[model samples]
Target: MQTWLVQHQKLLSQQLAQGRLAHAILLAGVAGAGKLSLANWLVQVVLCRQVQKNNDQGILSPCNSCKACRLYHQGSYPDFLSVTSDSKNIGVDDIRRISAFVETTAHLGKNKIVLLPMAEKMTTAAANALLKTLEEPGLSCVLILVSDDLDMLLPTITSRCRLYDIRPLSGQALLESLNRGQTQENLFANVSQLPELTDEQVHEQFRQFTARLLDFIIKRQNRGALLALLNENTYAFRWLEYMLVTMARSQYNWLSWSALRVKLVTAEGKSAATGAAPGDAIGQLPDSETIWQIYQLVVGCIKQLKSMVQVNAAYLSEKLLVDIETRLDK
Candidate 1:
């Protein structure tokens, strides 16, 4: 129930109240937009046998006393399915399993819900495997897709979903709300990675990669930071862009505007987007030719994968690695 997401909850709850919610929902936004939180909230509301509305706002919330709510809270809800992955991509097998689960009847005789926190991380095969399920998600099955980047998902997937764009409050509004209800520091770090907003462990993992990349680029001192691994990550290209922005900010002493949209201004100053001189830290950097090639390789790979043709995802990732290595890791 983050402040910025309260309106979304109310809007979704009102839809549920009217029995007009879609079978498949896509909550699309930036990292700090609370996509997963909103998904979880919607799932709880759907699963609650006795949903209660707040007196002040009329927004519905789960009645935790009911058997269904109890089971869900215990993490043993038979009707709830969350597709997850340990590796960089969710493979075809994972989608097949979920598709089978979707076909089954709900154990509670109520609605079933499937949560895909990183829908965009599904491999090309996995996404294709999921098309049948997405196209025909019955009334009993409520599939909730949470994606920070819609561009990474297949068009068929995005087209089938009832989309909701979850945007955050900004400027004075965000600052005032946060100031009024500030809690722990970790809860509001103002960083923008989807994993960073939801899970601390994953956030740490991403930052570790960022640190290693900084070492590789800034110090030429690598601690096992490989561009090949970025090929496997769904957010690889975005992460590269994020790193460069950070580098640029540090180099020029910019005010550190976040791509995630949590704006902050400190040490007030002006920064022009000017390239550094030859042999300068920022000038010898960027290496536009190499970065552009990397960008092109990624765009090509994504285009091939998200389309209908059954291209080999593994082959694409491998090709990306090969194309970037000679150019990137010098």
Candidate 2:
């Protein structure tokens, strides 16, 4: 678990040592990037009783075996406050309750930690109420907000906090985690248990998947398209996520190489407005300002969909695709 969080830990420890820690931190990441886990670790570090007081720099480290760590693991830490979702939106009253709690001193650690998970889900009124607390954070108070949907958060709230963008564990790291005690042969055997799928079959499945996803996006324009895609199954959701990530990566690559004006003509004969197919002008990619905007929008939609904050996945998908096509003049 610590392996996935080593980078964040290092930065946080540096801050604690220098006594330059921000009163509030905003963690932005895709879902499953372990933002909540990092927040929990941070709370433990700030609240651990056995942490050395003499070493200002050393105080950053949390003794995982200490009583404080144990209590935190058990979810009974008195000083650590966590506000999470029970429903769609966090109400103004919730923020008020937190404000009331923050007025008191810590019962355990030297610091008071308030964690707001899915902070973007807080309603407009709730966010406004929290803004007051942010303006005047009490002594020893640390505000940590976890939001996968950074777009939904008010700009004022974001500007007040230092932002950390968390990312997924690399493939090698994931495999190592999954195969800790297992041999390579054993891992291969486990993989081999699944039937092999041919490339064509896989591509066909993906094509149909993309079609159904588009159907969902354009349901208002084409309602019947979503019926076959949605029998209360999770596959539709999973594929949408996969395609969004894939498209985002593709767009990023295009943008990165835009200085060359490299033209990449897909085998499908789709050409850019200038008649340069995707691969036609390999050394002359155009300016990427327009592509970057589309990329951000697509990523925002993905984050909203994953958090279940946006109800119209199909509609958003259709709009995004149309925008992309229009940008390319396809």
Candidate 3:
């Protein structure tokens, strides 16, 4: 468990100890915040026949040797149901399957757990189908819904479950956590604007890609650099969108994750050459209106990428870079 989840784990432990655990729990947080991990941990606790409680800290944990825990670890737990969407949305059939699972008896004489990893992806009919089961779940059934955006869920679905909001750790804490076992050079290299990235190599690559994109934008030239970066990474559109948003926030003197990342990257480069303290070069970004216009342009390109008809990525990227240069010229 990460340090960020310690408090939530303790709270849920207390509820379990008192036999007051809710039948349905809605775990809400941004992507990569470990909401799914927390839900899985909670399921193990609820299903474990031998749950251990530390007298000193009063933390609850599952005993791995228990039959229920063993089955879960082996991925052969009959009572556990994990639901996910294959298409754009989880249709009513998915919810109906969950309902059927809930109606069955637990095979391990423990709580039957049904986990929906992306609850927000459920269609309206699917959500409606889940309402009645959430209201009156089986005596030993637990439903856990994990969502990156709680607002996308139906009000009736959210209102029926106990909501637990998870948050990212502070910048310093997060840096320390992510930098464990990493050298100083690699530590700074791996810093990212993303809220969370579990893989160090992927994080570092993303940072590098973002840096190149930022260099082109800040210089208001370097069309070649922009094209090179886009050609090398499939996630160029996402990086461009992030850069535009950061520039917009910088104009308002607001410090977003991307804005902070921009400052860090710029400061590192400047400090290496001039021997001066790192400063906020992000404040030199273009005006807010200009940034918004560029952002909308990137947004449109992203939608086009998602269209049914195939679009040439290289051509689209070049066109976007040209449009951005034009905007900067004005």
Clash counts per candidate, in order, are: 0, 20, 0
Measured over all alpha carbons after superposition, the RMSD of each candidate to the real structure, in angstroms, is: 7.5, 11.8, 6.9
> Which pairs of residues collide in model 1?
none
Candidates' C-alpha lDDT: 0.68, 0.61, 0.74
Which has the greatest TM-score? 3
**Model 3: per-residue Cα lDDT over 1-330, one tens digit each:** 777777888999999989999888999986667788899899888888889996566778899998888989999989999998766678889999999998888777677899998898887788989997776634578889999778778899999899999886645566677664443333233223433256566555666665566556666645786687776764566667776776677677775534355334532454321223555443245678888998988899878755523357678888988898798779
TM-score of each: 0.67, 0.56, 0.70
> What's the CA error at residue 282 for candidate 1, in Å?
13
Q: Evaluate model 1: give its TM-score.
A: 0.67
Sorted by TM-score, highest first, which candidate order results? 3, 1, 2
| Residue-wise C-alpha lDDT for candidate 1, range 53-146, written one tens digit per residue | 9767668999999999999899998999998887667889989988898888889898889998888888888988888887763457888989
CA lDDT, candidate 1, residue 114: 92
| Candidate scoring better on lDDT of 1 and 2 | 1
